[model samples]
Target: MSLHEDAVLVLKAYEGRDEQQRALREVYLEHLAEHPDAMYKPCGAGHVTGSALVIDPEGGRVLLTLHKKLGLWLQMGGHCEPGDATLAGAAMREAVEESGIASGLTLLEGGPVRLDRHPIPAPCNWHLDVQYAALAPAGAVAEISEESLDLRWFAYEEVAAVADTSVVELLEATRARLGA
Candidate 1:
């Protein structure tokens, strides 16, 4: 099946634990149904982007990058590429690429942690982010990529003070999934 079809199935099967997630799932489904290119970045209206929060559960810390262009502390994520076969695959790809952890990084199971819709510069009006959390193996070391100005691990409690609300929410949902 195509990535678009996979996204539809994933969203439909997503049993959102909250009203907001359920609402956003519908919006994503509608967007995908209306625009076949919604999985690509060139979509004029908006597009689906995949993101993964890098979490070191044992260390009780989360990895966040200072985005090169946006200059904000955020999770590793970006536009979908042609090679991406599924939304979760795209999320995992971005996570590994941005985090520079070549191996042992695993995505949290049970699908996406959350969905966030945020406005962006023109050409593309919005980024409909499907967020997931990746479990970083112990002793994993991260190197900053061209897309980031800096990369570092922050204690779970420090996330809110540094990252925007969306990142914090993703972390909370991830932690809930982790049962921490």
Candidate 2:
């Protein structure tokens, strides 16, 4: 099946849940199905992507980036490509590329922490975000990318104070996975 078709199948699987979620996924699936090639190319729209919440092994901190476009501290993530075999793999690839972390970085074995959808402004559909969590050794420095204005480690409490409301759930999920 085409990526768009796959997206529709996945979204349909979640019907009768949250209204906002259903609407956002429907919008993305419709747009994507109408423009299948847009998936391979950067739709110039935010488009659906994956993200990673890189947690410190000590369980005290998490790596976050100040997104260049959104101007808010968030986990590393971006547009999915046709090359990705699965959504999880796509999330891992985007995390490594955006954070400049080595491919060898160990990711948690389970699936994503959560799925979120949000509009990316005009002329483009929303992003269907599959967020995952990974553990990195304390003191590991991220190579940082142009995609973000800055990368920093924040304590869990500190993160709660400043991170976007959209990301708090991810942080909580990551922390729970780590048993922090």
Q: By TM-score, who's the top model here? A: 1
What digit string (tens of lDDT, one per residue) describes model 2 on residues 1-180?
A: 665555556555544235665576576567666766545436655466778888775758888989898889998877777777656667778778777777455677656666677767766656768677877865677888878899888888888787987688888866666676
- Candidate 1 local lDDT, residue 102: 98
Residue 156, candidate 2: C-alpha displacement in angstroms: 0.8
Candidate 2: residue pairs that collide: none
In model 1, which range of ten residues has the least summed lDDT?
8-17
The global C-alpha lDDT for each of the candidates, from Candidate 1 onward, is 0.95, 0.71
Model 2: what TM-score? Answer: 0.75
Give the distance in Å from residue 86's predicted Cα in candidate 1 to where it truly belongs: 1.0
Model 2: residues with Cα > 4 Å off, grouped in runs: 1-46
Candidate 1 per-residue lDDT, tens place, 155-178, comes to: 999999999999999999999999
Q: After superposition, how far is residue 41 of candidate 2 from its true place, in Å?
A: 6.2
